[model samples]
Target: MSGSSKKPMRRAVVPVSKTLPTDPQDQHSSSEEVDPIFFTPSPSPPSNTPTPDNASALPCDHATGEPHRHPNPTRHPDFWFHDGSIILQVESKLFKIHQTILANHSEVFAGLFDVPPPLPTGTTEGDDMVLEGCRIVVLHGDTEKDFESLLRAVYNPSYFDDTLPPSADVETLLDFISGILHLSTKYLIRNLRQRCINLFTSKFPATFDEYTAKSTPQPSYSSTRSSSHKQERYRSDTLMRALHLAHSCNITTSLPYLYYCTARLSLHRLLKPRPTDVDWQTKSVVLAGRERLRYATLAISYSFLLVFERAPTCAEMRCGFASGPGREWRSIVLGGESGIGSAPTPPTAATSITNAGGVNGISASATAERKSKSSSNRAPNPLRLYTRWPELGVCDRCVEWNKGVHERGRREVWERLPGMFELEGWDELRKAQGS
Candidate 1:
């Protein structure tokens, strides 16, 4: 529900402040397991600020009484991201540091963005927008040496943010990732809602396929006519960057579904069939379908988590299709959305009234019943991937993360199995849930 504006992103103390404490480096740390944070669908930030471009007219939607569709500074330009196009802008030293990291981790970045996410193809790093922002206040000069020093400071892996005592320990990074994941999921949610609602009223695609029509990678994309290039893909390097940030904070989440949905909604443009399109019995069977086994071979620990927990919120959110919310609730353990809470709050049966002659007390799953009923009556297809991760479903590719990050060789103490993915306090989280 973030307000629609020129910008798709908004800066706030909300997530960053909330996330600073969860940076556990890995979930095995001895710190107490902090509870999980659920998702909150706040309306997009208000786009009340008038741009010089709109000086001629008032910013109002006469029909809906909403703001006009204008870009918000908070959001990166859609042109740089959507359609068969690419964007490579380097305005400041911050871009230099980002380029350094991007260069060092290009493979991973490629996997995340699903395209050659803009390389340092722009002018000097001094000209990058992100870097320029930093230079104005923090870095000052746009030299590599100065930027490197700043890079050392920003991702210091130490407890200090810009001289002031670090507002967070290293765990803040993980929260950053979680926040991004939430945003990515949020992006899917809001966009999909708009699409579904529009399609329902008028069966046409909601904005053109941003991916198919354009790309913003540094290098141009593969020739559009190549048959070999048909593996249409979607992976937001931006979203992945957020995922990495969240990992730095020791928060855990699912990339499989995020990637899958991004690939579908962002790339291929065809969503999987929804449960609402059919009936519940068939939906339940579809959920427990053979596809579940596709992820069984990733990593041992991940397999365990997958098997025990199953896909919870992500599955529910990824596709409107879900196998009864009740079953989903039992399997879910954490999230940042209303339906997806951090830890499962044990349901308590209560004494209450009922319809007609039945004066029975409220049943334990009364909440679930209400959810299903309400969702059933709704008139649109739901987009839940951007809302929940594992809760929705995991893809075949990322299933390997759970057993450990490095399956190929030896790992340092800090690089232990749990260390790589940034879920340092799993022991704490596990204990918190009395698992």
Candidate 2:
């Protein structure tokens, strides 16, 4: 009976009135403003005594009426945050930040917060006290802009989130990363510091070939490919900064690769004293890198010429190649002309081969000469030979042979790169980085 005959009861709804705060001018009535748990007021007025005109005063110091204390001059214009509760005045600029957040990320800050209260005389057991306000701290010696950059990274949620915002520009991105690394090192934030190093390494690879490989074409199966898919190339300054940062931070794994790329810069740029603080590439490293490259270049040049000299005489049936006179390969590189000068040639046919005895001697002499040349030019770069081989008027068989040599030479150079720079092999570097 209850199921069949009972009518459903309807709940009544009540409407409540909403009003603004008592003051009509109060626009922030709906949201609560964050207030500090503790506040330390400024000190009492100073007595009328002649203060020095150049006496430095803290930014937060508001002592009214003295021997006329000058107003504290402003220093950092870019980092002044109106809403920051803890005022960290670095130079002339005041940086308002949350102490708990800073303490969470840095041991130095945590230690600062853990300090016991000052004595009645405004001294902390022989340590100098900061300004009157408990929240106002003074910093000296470090660049204010760098400190600002560190704060931005700490407060910005994008870096900590899974989705990172696109970097506005390479230089800006580099400065941000560098700032983070510098502060992280100072504060002992190992995880954050390592993350900055990783980002830098990913952009500026350790090997010359790896840097080139970043631009290598990727196969796209999609029907609709756009220009946006291509990334902008990093500038030369960015590379220099990466190298400098690597050296400053003791990132040994990135050194050889960075040195290789820097050596590729023109002699003038590489040899010049670093133009600015940011351009921190070490002169000594560049010198060593250049010396190694010079030796490699000379070896390659000699190898190319040796290969050209030892190639067999033309066989007419196999392929069409210029023969007889006026078809020799021209030298295009440094030391290419003097290449075979270092190589010894066998005695001429008229001077030696009088009969069977002379014939065998001539064959052995030629063999010895070729062996000496090959040994002298042991550091070969086959790729350079392949590029210049077309001008040599060689046959298809010879071209293919040179191509194989070029590929082998490239592989050898890459494998020996770490040793050339006097560092551990690539595998060891990667292992140390926990890659």
Candidate 3:
């Protein structure tokens, strides 16, 4: 039945005290303490009958020999179907959903339903319980929000619609997906698990080329209002949560890029992580990887510039000279950290020749103009490929040679990314994903 067409139902609540035994294979065992669900036959008395002064002394169900009710809260507004065969309690919320729907999607639920309730011993209060004339199965470890997301996704086809508008709130989307992924994995719902994995991979692509292709230009960073700062904080927290989720779910392919992004966060931000931030071990790994990235930035990304080796085919004396445009370009790109004492002045139009189409097909004048405009504000992004080699005032041959060297360096860095973050190689990660 459509969720919209279903009216809410009020039912008696039964609090359960007994928790489920820990499943050796359950991923959530280490994180959440789950209680086992008990089932009992419906009580003989009508649910609406006035409670006796000593209601706690009520007799147990004759069939199962289990207590029938403990008043708490009403049924869930959306998921409580009058015809539902089973009642699931997640915290204070109660969902009267179908066993068939759950069994169709989850092997765990199917196996659960296959096992009939134990023969009642009549010794324990919670050995078996009932509510609203249906069996109550309490999910002890799960939160109402997460269980609600799972049911919503199951009952409504359009709940997790992917064709969201461009301006959809990213944080909300991620939260929804994360919650679904968690329960789906626990319940062994393969399709929903795969859907969540696909969404995560799209955001954090497994391949380097895809990652580069989707890379957004880094925004200019500056101090902002309290709201902006809060937004930044939320983004950081979300990133940390995503990293943890990827690890827990064995979404290995996304780890390197996630680690790389974590490495790029400022030291202050890293040091002052949220209380529920990625663990100390993860933080240490990121810090180590950040240092490696810094070394890679200078040693690989700008290797050609560091040595200032002119192309053998270069004819321009200005390109070949150690103190010429190459030195000035190095100073500009490296922020004068290449042993040049002070920040060298930008090359003037007189000193720089206007090549019609230089590096990456960008004209020398345009490159120079862009450089002049943003040079002061732009921070050096090590992973970014330098495409304005013509701004070095070097000849076409030297520019092409440097470009080739830079491209090779970037490819090497991509290959080494997993190692830098202490993760398995991409091939192994891909294999794990398939498995």
In model 2, state the lDDT of residue 203: 65
lDDT of 1 at 266: 20
lDDT minimum window of 10 residues, candidate 2: 15-24
Model 1 Cα lDDT, one tens digit per residue, 59-118: 222234454343221212322222322222112211223433332333222222232223
- What lDDT tens digits, residue by residue, belong to model 3 across residues 164-188? 3434454755776877877776676
The local distance difference test score of each candidate is 0.27, 0.47, 0.61
> Where is the poorest 10-residue window by lDDT in model 1?
132-141
The best candidate by TM-score is: 3
In the range 185-301, model 2's lDDT, one tens digit per residue, is 555456677777766666666654654455445556674653223545545566677766665544556766666666555555655555542333355656565556545543553
Superposed Cα deviation of residue 93, candidate 2 (Å): 2.2
Clashes of each: 86, 5, 4
Q: How close is candidate 3 to the true structure, as a TM-score?
A: 0.65
> Where is model 3 poorest over a 10-residue stretch in terms of lDDT?
13-22
Once superposed on the true structure, which residue ranges of model 3 sit more than 4 Å away at CA? 1-73, 116-134, 162-166, 216-234, 308-319, 322-381, 433-435
Question: What is the descending lDDT order?
Answer: 3, 2, 1
Shift in Å, residue 311, candidate 2: 17
Ranking by TM-score: 3, 2, 1
Positional deviation of residue 370's Cα in model 3 after best superposition, in angstroms: 27
